[model samples]
Target: MSRYVLERVQLSAQNHPKRHAAVSCAIGGLLVAATSALSVIQRSETVSWPAVIAVAVIGGGAWAAAMAVFVVRLQRRMKPLPPETDPARVRAARRLMRNGELGPDPETNALAVRMAEQLQSIPRWKKFTTTAFLCTTILGVLVTAPAISDGEVGKSVFYGACTLFPLLMLTVGRARLDRHHRNAAEIRRAAEHRTNTEAER
Candidate 1:
């Protein structure tokens, strides 16, 4: 049973890859690199404004560019072109869905419901991961707060944005959790309806 549960979890994750987690890790890596580079630059005897701006802009631009490319690639993977490649097929699919005939067959729907139930572990894990990240961010900020000059409001604001980024990410994951649960419930209901209808026949 445990093996089945694990298999279902793996399958579900494969179907809906957690690109957000990858992006978050990328951002975290960039942040750490930037912080290290800043420390190295500041250790020099002469830290000119041009040098500071150059480092900041280069680091930030690289991070932004990486994120943009990642998003584009992820969007392509999430929404493939097969369905849209043929207009006739696309129209037919839309019509079936509209007429409530596009859903998975009975056996598939039952399997999906079971898979979804096992997949509940995903959202719970997400919640726990989010909470852990939040606590770590808070602690990190507190430990590093003294390093920044009190009058450097811009730097403080940047730090705040960095902290909030993870929170925003986890919030979206939580939303996906709710969506997953709703979809699972709908599949279960559909499967039960089918079972009853067949029995009555």
Candidate 2:
């Protein structure tokens, strides 16, 4: 659990490819929640800000939870490493300068690229779904509050707009994350090939 959480954080990147996007998503959620709380506290009027803030909190939490679940599921799908792994495999994968007869293995790299792309795409749906869940939870809580009345039609409009925002955010964030991964994979492959040829000769 702890290890998976760590990996999640690494993938949620601000700038680098190595930062866990899962952990990043979780942290982003907490921050959104915190911002919502602050917005609620700072407001002078009994405006619909409370509902908005509550919704934001819920969305953020949902994003984090969805990502954490993804990390757990992905780990289960991965096969454990070998006890006597090939030395060439280690050198080819880990040491950029030590590549011998091996370059990037096409079968594994292609499989990985496909897997990563699938992960990147599927998780966007998870993100949006979680976001929708979060907003629903917040809206439910707010609706029951003494302040919010079902009688007011305008509040429904407010809820709809606020609820949709997180999914939008998730869509944009996921797109950027996938783009970076593709670029990183290409660079890694290129470096591996160059080193493999240098070592071969």
Cα RMSDs of all predictions? Answer: 11.3, 11.4
- Model 1 scores a C-alpha lDDT of 0.54
Q: Model 1 over residues 4-107: C-alpha lDDT tens digits?
A: 44333333334444554355546765776577467546445488867766676677667656665654454434423232133333333333322333254433
What are the lDDT scores of the predictions, listed in order?
Answer: 0.54, 0.50
Off by over 4 Å in 1: 1-123, 140-149, 170-172
- Per-residue error for 154 in candidate 1, Å, reads 4.0
TM-score of each: 0.42, 0.32
Once model 1 is optimally superposed onto the true structure by TM-score, how far is the C-alpha of residue 172 displaced, in angstroms?
Answer: 4.5
**TM-score, model 1 to reference:** 0.42
lDDT of 2 at 35: 57
